[model samples]
Target: MHRIIFATGNEGKMKEIRMILKDLDCQVLSMKEAGIEADIVEDGTTFEENAIIKAKAIMELSGNIVLADDSGLEVDAMDKAPGVYSARFMGEDTSYDIKNNYILEQLKGLPEEKRSARFVSVIACAFPDGRIFTTRGVFEGFIGDKISGENGFGYDPIFWVPEFGCTSAELPPEVKNAVSHRGKALGSMKEKLKEML
Candidate 1:
């Protein structure tokens, strides 16, 4: 089977990507699976840039088609803060509980409408032939006053989807994968992947 290198160390992200592509003829392999390890510096100012930086680095090293993504929560009330900094909003080692609480405090006393936010995902697929395809997905919603649900990672607990009437964390894996920012981007890129594979 054709191998698609997914350049991420996060197992949660790797699992989600694999689940998304389970039906494809190709196989998605994590960095470890591919016997490649990288410590990429995600210093880009935007999601697309960071994704590209990561994708290119891995592709250059492995000489394979590599997919890399950078996603984050963009809160309108916070002037779109923590956009590219979502992973390290409260420092890299800080727990999500602390980070989530910090974000909640920033939007305290504000109504739901004022707490509008969105999760943005940018995916970069880099080929060894110096070719790249990039796609973006946005999940619109609001940030709740406190965390909820036991599912998902990062800001999922506080991300309230008005359409679902629940936080992303409250949704089942299948449901979340079908509607998440990463899911949308991966879905959009599915056909492209099929074509490329």
Candidate 2:
């Protein structure tokens, strides 16, 4: 079987990716599991660009099907202030509690409609033979006033999905994976991956 390498050190992200691509008839290994430690700087201005950068960077070393993703929360009220900067909204080392609080503060007093936001994820798959494929996914919802649940990472705690009537973090793993931006992107890439493999 072919090997698929997810280029990330974040445990949450690694787990999510594995779950998204679990059915593939190949090995899904994180960078650490694949025995690679490369500092990939994310300086791109867009999600797709960042994902491509990481995927290409890792593909050089992994020599396997390297998968990378760049995702963030884009709030309409904030004019998408945290679109590409979601991960570093309150500095790289700040806690998600602070991040969630900051978002709540920004949307204070605003109605749910104005609090509309979306989570965007761009996933890139790069092969050792120079073939690269990318897919994008967006989760539409509003930001909640309070952080609820601890099921997901990043802005999940504050992202409220109207369809689900709850925060993304509150949804079960299977449910979240079916509606999450990462899930959408990974799902869209499933056929491509099958063909590639």
Candidate 3:
């Protein structure tokens, strides 16, 4: 099987990607497993740029195919704030709980209808020949009044799905994968991979 290195240390993301790509003819390996720990600076203004930066950095270091993703919650009420900086919204070292709490406090007392938000994911794949490919996916929803689940990382708990009557974090793996931004992006990438290989 072809081996592709994913440039992320987040185990949750790693697990999700593995599940999404399980049926493919390639094996996805995390940077840690690939013995790569280089920290690529994410100074780009957009998610796509940041994802490309990461993937390219890893490809250069390992000289292997690499995929990197940059995803975040964009709140309409906040004017799309915490977009690229979602992970470091509170601070570089802030815990998920603290970040979640901060977001909740910011949206406190806002009307439910005005609490619109969406999760955006951009995945970039870099090849050893300096070729790059990218795909984007978005999951539209509103922020809940309060945190509701404990299964997911980042802002999953506050991201409510009206049709499902639950937060993204409350959905089971299969359901979440069917509609999640990362899943959609990876699914599209898989099609591209099939064509390329």
* Predicted model with the maximum TM-score: 3
lDDT (tens digit, per residue) of candidate 2 on 70-135 = 999999999997998888888999998998898899899998889989999999999999999899
The C-alpha lDDT values of all candidates are 0.91, 0.90, 0.91
Model 3 regions lying over 4 Å from their true place: none
> Which stretches of candidate 2 lie above 4 Å from their native place?
none
Model 3 TM-score, all chains together: 0.98
Better of 1 and 3 by TM-score: 3
**lDDT of each residue in 1-197, candidate 1, tens digit only:** 87789888889888788888888888789999999978999889899999999999999999888999999999999999889999988799999999999999999999889999999999999989999999999999999978998878889999998888999999998999999999999888777888877
Query: Can you list the residue pairs that collide in candidate 2?
Result: none
lDDT of 3 by residue, 1-197 (tens): 78899999999999899999898898789999999989788999999999999999999999999999999999999999899999888788988778877788989999989999999999999999989999999999999988888767889998998889999999998889889999899999988888986
lDDT of 3 at 67: 93
What are the models' TM-scores? 0.97, 0.97, 0.98
